[model samples]
Target: MKTLLLLEWMKVRKYKTFWAFIILFAISLAGINYFIHNVQIQTKSLTHGMADIQIFSFPQIWSTTAWAGGFSVLLLGILIITLVTNEYSFKTHRQQIIDGISRKQFISGKWLTIIVFIIFAWISYFILTLIVGNHTENISVFSGFDYAGYFLVKMAVSLSVAFMFALLFRRSGLAIALYLVYVFILEGIVKHFLDKIAGGLGMFLPLSAGGYLVSNPMRQAIPGIETIHIQPVWILLTCLGYLILFVYLSYRYINHADL
Candidate 1:
């Protein structure tokens, strides 16, 4: 474990683009959360029962902020893909094998990066959780910090998707483009039609399943409580299955394909 982490650190330490990505991800997360906080503040003015309710309030903070913050996991996913593909672009993947690192170890290094990215992203949310909870209009001493676990799983699922793409394409530009298209367009269209044909079962699509895991509350989010809302344990299990599949496929590509 320590050696794998050391290898990952060696790759990340001097990489300016990696640092840029980390900085960008942090700023984007904070910016998005701030935007949501302000939007909630403004919405409170409207004459509706929903107004004056803050998602960051203590009890709801875990789930509400997680659902709100989950969107930025895509950025983290892209960074992971880029970091992996950059090795190939630089031919450093070949050199690493020349330097006596086994293919399995190389893949392990990449996997370590995924673990680290997820951890950093989760820590960022933890800090934001404190900040958002501190300044929100209401407080109740926090009922369910358990929902943060769901947020972490959602992020792992997102990063795993990117890892699989990077392994398959081996080119950052093409891989990232395909990932976005699949997530935003292809999946959207297919899920729409599939939902109609398969009943509500279409919600179990890879991305949709992750969304269901830390689903938004009925009050703050647009989706009806009955529709987007799913039992977290089931969604968690489903997403973990997807995550395992993604990692296994990526590992196979890395393990079997010539560098």
Candidate 2:
């Protein structure tokens, strides 16, 4: 595993695009959370306490940051796609195999890279949550911190989905384009129709299952609407199922497909 990770690190260390994407993702996460924090403050002042929503406060901070982190994960997904597809574009995957590494090692290296990215993202969110939540009134630091775990699962599910696309397509352009379209348009449309036909079953979709883990905390502030709460365990299980499926499919492709 260390050899695999070190191999991935050697590749990533010199990759300018990887660093660019990492920087962009960090900025996006911080910038979006900062903007929302200001909005929450301004809303409180403008409404004169009539509509005070504590998004940055203790428990809510975890969910708020995790939810906000979702948007930034898109950039990471693109980065994953680029990294995987680059291996094909440059024929490095074949070179690695020719150099005595088995197909399993190559795919395992990719999976390790994905895990590293997930850890980086999760750490970024954790630090940002602490920095932002410190200014807000809160009793406990760890309250509602389970959202951090949910964020990890979300990242895994999302990046694995991207990895699967890259393995399936082997072209960055097509993989990324289809990924964006599916995430933003196709899945929503499919989920919409599925929900209409099956009622709530749409939540089982790959992204939706992960998304249901950390719902929008701000929605609780809205009046006259009952929020439908699903069990976290169920959502977690669904996400795990999709995660395994995506990883398995990617592994199978790499194991059998001619490079």
Candidate 3:
């Protein structure tokens, strides 16, 4: 298993796309921080009036990291999809199979890469949060752990779902674009409609539930639909279901495919 992991790590290290993604993620976070900094300057306060506006702040900079990384989940998903298809793109997976690496090892290696990247992405959020400003005294024992855990779980599910889409489509860009549509567009509409019909029940869905977990608490006290008040247990179950299903399908697909 260690040998397999080492070989996979080497492949990831050598892949230009992986490095390109890291660079992109960094640039994006920096760009968002810059924009948020400007907005903070303009407002100069967390709220405007009874309007209860959701204000951006330096202390909340981690949310920018979360947004950037969360938005990039589709890209990561596409990357995962492409990793497999790229074998066909480069005629490598077939050769690896011929060289005695089982399909199981190949699939496991890809999953390990995804999990490693997921951790890196979350850590990127944490480091940026520290850079932004102060941690509020309101942070409780459970609040801090729960907030962090929620962020990590949402990221994991997003990446896993992206992998599943890639497995289904086998084309990186198309699969990723589809994933983006689901996240940014389709889910938005669904949540809006659900909010009208069921109110807080929308929190049960992945995006809505995740919105509840990571949303700035102060922002939630204000008016407008409260997508951020989701229960931790529901988000946990939804994310876990996604992770398991994606991993299972990844194995089943690769094991049975014509490859």
Scored by TM-score, the top model is 2
Query: What is the alpha-carbon lDDT of model 2 when measured against the actual structure?
Result: 0.89
Ranking by lDDT: 2, 1, 3
Q: Residues 154-251, candidate 2, lDDT per residue (tens digit)? A: 88998998888888889999999999998899999999999889988888898988888877877777788755567889989999998888778877
For residues 1-259, what per-residue lDDT tens digits would candidate 3 score against the true structure?
7887798777778889977877877777667656755655555454554433233333344454465456555556667766756766677778888999999888887778788878887777667656664455664322334455677887777777666776677666777678778878888888778978987666666665666556643454445753444556777887677677778888998899977
- lDDT of each residue in 34-75, candidate 1, tens digit only: 787777777765646455655767767777778776767788
Give me the candidate number with maximum lDDT. Answer: 2
Return whichever of 1 and 2 wins on TM-score.
2
How many backbone clashes does every candidate have? 0, 0, 1
lDDT of 1: 0.80
Q: What is the lDDT of residue 147 in candidate 3?
A: 51
Instruction: Locate the minimum summed-lDDT window of 10 residues in model 2.
Output: 132-141
